[model samples]
Target: MKLNKHTVATRYAKAYYNLAEEHDCIKEAFDNMMDIRQIFGENPGLGLVLSDARLTLAQKRPIVDNLIKNFPELMQNFVLMIFDYDRMGDMELIVDEFEKLYDHKNRTILAKVTTAVPLTEAQKTRLADVFVKKLDGKKVIFDEVVDPEILGGVIIEAEHQIFDGSIRLNLETLKKQIAK
Candidate 1:
């Protein structure tokens, strides 16, 4: 099968992840990836500029060099390698994949919770408790989103599964039942 963006990103990220693990610099690599990801994410045009075929390596070298100046040697090499391969445009996706791999290796899972209003510390703790049980004791990181459109209750999204208990969904279901 042909390789898509996600596929290519996963492949590169896995390689980088293994390298980081071998070097015992997973944390450092993660930090470097985050910094690079943020830089590209904020200045999207820079990736395009660096990835442009019209620009010779000589033209791009200084830019890449300045970008990775503060990075560890291994990370500096990784960043430069991406530029060398004309993969700068894919940096963000690779960073995202790397983050997932890192999180999995660290036994942490990300949860997105949507509620009608902001949750209190106690509510967050309770929700975390629920997910901790469901995730087999893996540590949970919560990303909370407050949406009044949900009406009430909460929706929990983790590992591609959604547990939606919002009043809006309940109302829709009830309306369908009544119509039938």
Candidate 2:
């Protein structure tokens, strides 16, 4: 079987995670990973700087070092490692891989629930409780979002399954049934 991208990312990310854990810098490393992801994702110029062959490590390292000066030393070292390996283009995916490692280590599920309208605090609490109960009392890192395009109701994505009960889905189903 062919090795998938996720597998490759996980392998590299796990190495970083192991190093971060050894240095007792998982949180700092994770946070810096997030920051590096955002910086690379949102700023093409920053990415170009890293990818440019004309820019030597002597030049690039100091620039990046100053930007992440306050982050943990391991994070700084990780940046250098990535730069040395020329894996800067995969920064976002690597961070996502690292986050999965962090979440798995912490026994948490980062959930995302979206509804047409914002749920009340009580509603959020109740839904979060439902997830907690359903997961055999495992922690649910519940996150909720509102999308008016859904028209109404909710679409919850937790673990790897989706629970879609949105008004938009209902209307589509009704339309399909009517067409039939």
Candidate 3:
């Protein structure tokens, strides 16, 4: 049976969320995941270390131990589970999905804006305000990214929604209209 990445990610993320809920450590899980992602991102060598399945658990034990310092018990359990499943490469993806699940449970909706250039403070505030109004009862967490691919204007993405209004998008729309 082939496993789809999103389904696999959801399964692993949900399992961790369950453990976190039992221990009242959902926030801890989120923070620990963020920390782990940063560690993996900053030290690409960790991937090589984790991928060596030939290394005995005893040999790999120190790596896991030293890497787990101050992590919550739930995260420690998650780490152990990953090691058991040989899914350490998917840790970052798992964390991201876990965060989405966690936020869903908490009624937190994240909104991301990508534009060709940095948004002015007033523009960011107004954009967030508009999304907040549209997503009433859910917290609108805003993230504005600068993407040259956008050419101009903004691409707004919220939980369950995407509003692409960039110049690049408009050009594509115009091209489609002409073709039709």
- For model 1, residues 1-180, the per-residue Cα lDDT tens digits are 868889989998999999999998889889989998888878869888989899898998999999989888998888888887788888889999999999988878798999999999999998898888888757889999999999999999988899999999999999999999
lDDT of 3 by residue, 121-153 (tens): 898778777777777735767787889988998
State which candidate has the highest lDDT: 1
Residue 177 accuracy (lDDT) in model 3: 100
* Model 2 regions more than 4 Å off: 1-8, 38-44, 136-138, 142-151, 167-180
Off by over 4 Å in 1: 171-180
Residue by residue across 1-180, what tens digits does model 2's lDDT show? Answer: 866667767887999999988888888878888888777777776756866789787888777677668766777777777777766656667889998888888767788899988898899888878877776546777687889999998998877889898999999999999999
Q: In angstroms, give how far residue 102 of model 3 lies from its true place.
A: 1.9
Q: What is the TM-score of each candidate against the true structure?
A: 0.89, 0.74, 0.78
Error of model 3, residue 29, in angstroms: 1.4
Error of 1 at 67 (Å): 1.0
Cα lDDT of model 3 overall?
0.82
Local lDDT at 132 for model 3: 74
lDDT of 1 at 94: 94
Each model's lDDT comes to: 0.90, 0.80, 0.82
User: With candidate 3 superimposed using the best TM-score fit, by how many Å does residue 84's alpha carbon deviate from the native?
Assistant: 1.7
